[model samples]
Target chain A: MGTQAIRFVGYIFGAALLGLLALPVTSLVGAISVQKFLAGVYHPLFWPAISLSLRTTILSIGFVVLLGTPLAWWMAHQTSRIGRLTTVVVHLPIIMPPAVVGVALLQAFGRKGWFGTLLSAQGLNVSFTVAAVVIAQMTVAAPFYVQASIQAFKKISPDVWVVARSLGASPIEVFLRVGVPMAIPGLISGVLLAWARALGEFGATLVFAGNRVGHTQTLPLAIFYALESDIELALVFSLILVLVGLVVILVISQW
Target chain B: MVDTSLIVQVQVSLGDFMLDVDLSISMKGRLAVIGPNGSGKTTLLKTIVGSVYPDKGHILVGDRVLSDTKLRIEVPVEDRQVGYVPQDYTLFPHMNVINNVAFGLSTGGRRGSRACKKEIALRMLGRFGCQQIAYRPVQQLSGGERQQVALAQALVTEPRLLLLDEPLVALDMTSRRVVRLLLQNYLSQLDIPTVFTTHDVRDVVSLADSVIVLSRGKVVQMGTLEELQKQPCNDFLVEFLGQQ
Candidate 1:
């Protein structure tokens, strides 16, 4: 083949890969009528699942920011054995299978499991509870926020922090005024990714939290439940997730 | 004019290199710390500003003890009340010029409301003749303007001492003249002690009243430029100065 032909073939190959990924979402949308989609959206299962998803995802993001910010700042600025180990541990969830995360949470927090037994003895249970949904979501999503936060904090030159300190800005003041503002765009991207991950969490929530409507059944779990009985409800949940994902990506790219 | 003196006796180890420097200068204007690369000039400035802790000894500015290793008293950077303008300016890119300058005043509750702090920042920017670009973002500024804003940011707190690290290193020749003259004018007017590091002899000649030359993390010579010209401490000093 000629050079131009080779280039054209390569372009088509790349586009074909991209189209394969996009086809499911577009075809799913095209298959459903607007009226049916809206009706499914307003279904009784839909509202409860969405409310649970929103509650759990928002709380997970809150925890991630509160806990992950300090971890990221420290990890990015220091170079110790502990810091390196923490970085590796924080980044593992991004690549680890969600099912494995679910299994791990189950074994660690089940009624008869370690710490779970201790908690259960004290009249508390973590597995198969609403709190388990939050915990599972956090376990799988907090890493995304923390890893991105580390990158964000690292991008800012330490010299700026040094200058802020020299100018009499306290540690907290420097973080709030100088560090956070400088890395806002990256941090926002991290937050969006974490929230989306938590919203779409399935395997972990299913195993650890269990799919119970109005309790632990999030949107993803609702979609799973709908798959067995009503395909239309599942399609609506998938569509909402697709739209949200698009909006998030659009906002992040603009920022 | 009340005399302001800075006494530093510090010993620090920097990765297989020992940096021991002792000096006492009653600073009226600018005191230029001129040295070659790897001479620990920047380290000394960092020690004074509390970024790098000394393994031993103490630093005193006027009557205030900034660091005392023996007594286990070490004042943090925020409490030192020292204005620092680092090399390359390092202005907060997220803020505008006015806000960067205002950061020094408004932080740590030393200043009042935002409006009140901004008023002071505007006057400080006006002093440096860059008040027109006060609202411009720092990332959009030219090198010289960034340095000017950095200086204004450092000075807004009315600090007891000033530490400038290579203020002219990043500027082009055209802007270097402007920045140097601006710095000279400001240094001459400020009564507080000032210590600035530079490699250029011209900077030391025009901006500083006394010179401290460093070699291999140690002070090799300390005297006025006139005195150094009369008697060179060693061949390194003479060769580094490019004079007999």
Candidate 2:
């Protein structure tokens, strides 16, 4: 074939692949009309799940930023053995199945589990609670932020940090004013990715936090339950998810 | 006299190379560290500035001991009150020229209100003739402009000692001459001891009062430019100085 013909064939193959992947989600989009979706989405059960998901995901993102920012910053500066090791350990969640994370968290924090026994003594139970849901979300999502943050901090020249320090900026001032500002773009991207991961978290929340209504049922769990009860309700939830996912992707790409 | 004497004795092992140097400069001294590539000029400068710690010896600026391995006293870089401009300029890309110049003064060395800091930064930039570009981001600045801002940033804090790594090395011939004149004018006004590294002997002739020749991580010779030129201590000094 001529070069132009080969190019044409390549375009065709690319388009076909894109179409194949988008078909299922596109069909789900077509399955729900805005009017119908709006009518069904106002159900008593729907608002609670929506609020719970928003609350937990937002809180989980806050936790990730609070914990992950310092961790990533410390890890970035550390040349010690523990620092090097954590670089490898931080990515474990991204590769592990979400269900595995759910199980692992359960083993560590379940009522009868290691830390859970100690906590339970003080009348605290984390398992099958909204807090468990947030924990599961964080476990699966924090790595994305941490990994991105580490790379961001690494991209900065050591000279910049040194210059800042030598300029008489205290360590805390250097980090807050210089390091954080310089790495803001990457940090922002990391936050977006982590939020998306937390939003879609399913298997871990199901296993660890359970699928209880009004108490622990987030949007993803709500959708699953909707799927078993009414097809239209499930379609509405899926459409909302797809829309949220779309908005997030658009924002990150544009940013 | 400003009592700006700097006494340095430092030994640091970097990779397979070892750097050992002992030197002293009087107040208002302008020392040019001249050497070929990998001659440890930058390493020595960084050592004195507290970026690279010396395995042995101490650095004293005036009466204050910046680093004393024997006394187990090592001042933190932030507390050293040294202004440093790396070879690449190392301007914070995210900040504008005003903010970059204002960094050191606002952060720790001197405390001023935000408006006062901005006013000081503008005056510094005005001295460099770069006040027009005060709001432009560092990334958007030209090489000469960046160097100007970097120098302004270093000097605004009114550091006790200044360390500049190849401040004029990155500019073209015209800009280099312009910046050299600007630096010479400004540096002459400051009574503090200043140490700058350079590959160009012209820079040494115009900007430096004394020259330190480094080779293989050791000080080969130290003297005035004319003295070094008049008396060739070694072939390296003769060749290095003869190049100008």
Candidate 3:
């Protein structure tokens, strides 16, 4: 049997499966009881979660970028075993069970844990605060940024950076002007992907941030909150995630 | 007033491959570092340009003692003011020809004003007859144009010495002829010394004031191109010297 025919068949079957998956969502949106959705959209809890999600995810993504760029650059340039090991270690949260990430964050930051007691004594609490949510988001999302940035850096010829230095661009200038600009497409796409992952972080968010409505309750928490009683609110959160995710895809598509 | 002789001694280990070489050069004189790939030709360039630290060595250029393992004297690349044009004329793709050249005018030295930077770059471009492409992105340039932009960038800084690694590798035949003519003219007219690497004897015939041939990480011969051509000592020299 010619495999070309099988590949064509696979493409048709794959597209049909995709259409089937899309049908329910299309039908649901078409059959939306507008009153329920509109009312749910206006519901006081909904917008707050959206705002909180945006704030925390953006903050986490910001730090991820700030710390990740140099780390990725270092990993790309370094010729050491430690650098390789650190690269793998940084990716642990991605493969980790979500519940394990939550448990680990608590152990590391909880009062009896390593730095938690010190943080509490110093007049700041992270375990049940907005900061904790950002930390949780960062823990799981940072690897994406690091991986993408490293790949982006890899695409560039290291010799160009060497030329920049010889030509008088500082290390900082080289990173900002040459390195960053060249890697913009990969970095931007990765950041968006990280934001998407962070936006939906639930298990880690719940255990680490301790969902407090209007404080640390991100949209994912709100979805969980809504799922217990109000399916409409849950549907609204799900719809918002889908909308934002599509927007991310569109934005990244431009890059 | 100062010695321009560059005394370089360095060692680096890449797993089982180790590079240990001692080399030297002088100002107002051109030295060619010719060698096969992985024979440490590029490594010597990197070390001299301050991109890589030598496990052990001394690198002195002109009046400056840039690096010496014995004294642990190290001057960072930003302060070295050495102009380097790497292989492919690796011009910044995003920058126009003017900006690419202007990049050389900034080291740890007082950053020239934007107007000054542009002015300096333009002068160099004009000198090289590349003013017409001053506003074009280097990526859009022909190989020769890219080489011109890169060279113009390096020269605009008024560097102490030029460090070029295979400067002619990127050019097409026609463009290479034109660029080579311009480059040869510039080399003769300018007083500054330069060091460059190449696999082509044309580099020797056209621009090199003196030639330093390296075979397997060691200098096989050093002399004027005429002297080498007249007396081809080794098989490698005979084989290399006869090529087009």
Best of the candidates, DockQ: 2
lDDT of 1 by residue, B135-193 (tens): 99888999999999999999988888999999899999898988898888988899888
Clashing pairs in 1: none
A1-255: candidate 1 lDDT, tens digit per residue: 999999999999999999999999998889789898899888999999999899989998999999988888888887889988888888787777888888888888999888789999999999999989999999998998988888999999878888999888999999889888888898999999999889889999998899998899999999999999999878988899888888888988987
lDDT tens readout by residue for model 2, A30-83: 888888788768977789998999999999999999999989988888898999
| DockQ for each model | 0.78, 0.82, 0.67
> Per-prediction TM-score of chain B?
0.95, 0.95, 0.90
lDDT of candidate model 1 versus the reference: 0.89
Off by more than 4 A, model 3: A8-35, B1-4, B9-12, B109-111
lDDT accuracy of residue B113 in candidate 1 = 84
Q: What TM-scores do the predictions have? A: 0.90, 0.92, 0.92
Candidate 1 chain A, poorest ten consecutive residues by summed lDDT: A87-96
Candidate order by DockQ, highest to lowest?
Answer: 2, 1, 3
Model 2, residue pairs in steric clash = none
Question: Fnat per model, in the order given?
Answer: 0.91, 0.92, 0.72
